[model samples]
Target: AFILGFALKDILANFFSGLVLLIDTPFSFGDVVALSDGSRAVIKKIGLRVTTMYLIDSHSEIYIPNANFQGENIINLSRPTSHYYYTISIPIKGDVDPARAISLMEKVVLAHPDTMGELEGKLEAIDNYYGHSGSGVKQKLKREVGRMRLLAEQDVTRMLLKIEMSLKQLSEF
Candidate 1:
């Protein structure tokens, strides 16, 4: 009984520590965090001495020691409800009006099938100082486009990729 109690105490301590780390730490389950080497991952589990995450590009799972996580910069995409903001740049030559290009890009982004009904969208152009020199116009956009009620991370990536391709095509035109 004494040995069992000792083991149980250690287990309970670890579990509570895991829970506390989950709350106090910057990253949480399902957050896409960028590691030191620019490797991105979506956290899957927060354990006492380790954290489990899936790499974004390769779909590979990784276990990171919690001790190493201290002071590490992590991007938490899950805490704010899985919404993401991205900028799309479109280069326009002297012939094309910058305002017109901005408007067109906004239309394309807002009209995209993946972006249309999924989330509220905001599209706008960033100011460029040069005003010429083959300068590109940047559209600052934000969306909560991924479906949260169903589908897993892979499905979300596929949807995002589709949206990205559509945006690229629009920019090319």
Candidate 2:
């Protein structure tokens, strides 16, 4: 009787906690959250016994006990803004100046007209680079791109490339 009571206590706690989480809205569907284990994932669903999440790094779904949040911090990356941001990395030659690279990137991004004007697309260097070892390349740009702009730019780029090829063929003929 005593063991059953203790087991039921944990289950009841989880059930109630799940209800509170659903109502409180600490996170929602598709909202990305960082778990205490350092796993960043998107909320897939919330159930009575567990909260389901799809881990970004592992590409797997995990069930976190409803009562699990009590022990760790949950960083909600999407709660602040509905617009999701993605990183676009640009690799420059080792000898190229960082400032000039940034300026050229700005021009290329601004020319697209889809970067959402005056957005000041952020540029920051990342540590990972795969150039020749002796070159000492210290600059790589990471820019935040909106979902819509990313898709649109991809389509536009493909179309422009096709057009360029057609123009070249016409000139040759």
Question: TM-score of each candidate?
Answer: 0.37, 0.46
Query: For every candidate structure, what is the RMSD over all alpha carbons to the true structure, in angstroms?
Result: 15.0, 17.3
Q: Judge candidate 2 at residue 100 and give its lDDT.
A: 90
Please state the error at residue 22 of candidate 1 in Å.
2.0
- In the range 135-159, model 1's lDDT, one tens digit per residue, is 3343122122222311343454465
Rate residue 14 of model 1 by lDDT: 58
At residue 68, candidate 2 shows an lDDT of 83
Candidate 2 lDDT, tens digit per residue, 1-173? 99999889989989978866765668766568999888899988878779999999999999988998777799987655436555788778999999998866655554332233332231111112212133433412222223343444445446556766776799999
For model 2, the superposed segments whose C-alpha errors exceed 4 Å read 81-173
Supply every candidate's count of residue pairs whose N, Cα or C atoms clash at under 3 angstroms. 0, 0
Which residue pairs overlap in candidate 2's backbone? none
**Deviation in angstroms for 92 in model 2?**
32
Q: How well does candidate 2 score on lDDT at residue 146?
A: 36
Check candidate 1 and list the clashing pairs. Answer: none
